[model samples]
Target: MGKGDKKSKRGKIINGTYGTRRKRKIKRKPSIEEKINVEKKK
Candidate 1:
């Protein structure tokens, strides 16, 4: 049960694109420490 799975609204003035504006779900770059830990895990 998620947004992408939902059907688009009919006859809407402004259609949502990628749902980025509605929610800031963009992924930020990982810190230097985090990158090192991830590499160690592998």
Candidate 2:
């Protein structure tokens, strides 16, 4: 329930770590339309 608790989100954040309670953000790929636009610009 606190910083010492590894299973809690607050604890994960305080420890600067990721776990079941704190999932890392996923990087999104550019959409097909965006890629086409970039190619057109080039």
Candidate 3:
């Protein structure tokens, strides 16, 4: 279970792929300042 193992995080990264072993980053919500600007534009 090392870099050659597809089920491991290191293996996922080496393979340039994502799976249960390597989760993709989630999108963050807009910050308070950004939210205010969006409201002003409306």
Candidate 4:
């Protein structure tokens, strides 16, 4: 069981997603340079 499972112990499921949010970890954090580049293209 994961964090979501523990929270929804009553068998209730979290909406708007296929999985739980609490268990989801950040895969990456883009650098400041990347952010600026995206804006410049627009």
Superposed Cα deviation of residue 28, candidate 4 (Å): 0.7
Worst lDDT run of 10 residues, candidate 3, spans 1-10
lDDT of 4 at 24: 51
**Compared with the true structure, what per-residue lDDT tens digits does model 4 show for residues 7-42?**
453322433233352355569988999999999999
Clashing pairs in 4: none
Clashes in predicted model 2:
0
Which candidate comes out best when scored by TM-score? 2
lDDT of 2 by residue, 1-42 (tens): 898998899999999999888999999999999999999998
Candidate 3's residue-wise lDDT over 1-42, tens digit each? 888999999999999999997899999999999999999999
Which ranking of candidates, highest lDDT first? Answer: 3, 2, 4, 1
Alpha-carbon RMSD to native, per candidate:
8.0, 1.8, 3.9, 6.8
lDDT (0-100) at residue 5 of candidate 1? 42
List TM-scores for all candidates, in order: 0.38, 0.69, 0.59, 0.37
Where model 3 places Cα greater than 4 Å from the true spot, the runs are: 28-42
| Ten contiguous residues minimizing lDDT sum, candidate 4 | 9-18
Tell me which residue pairs clash in candidate 1: none
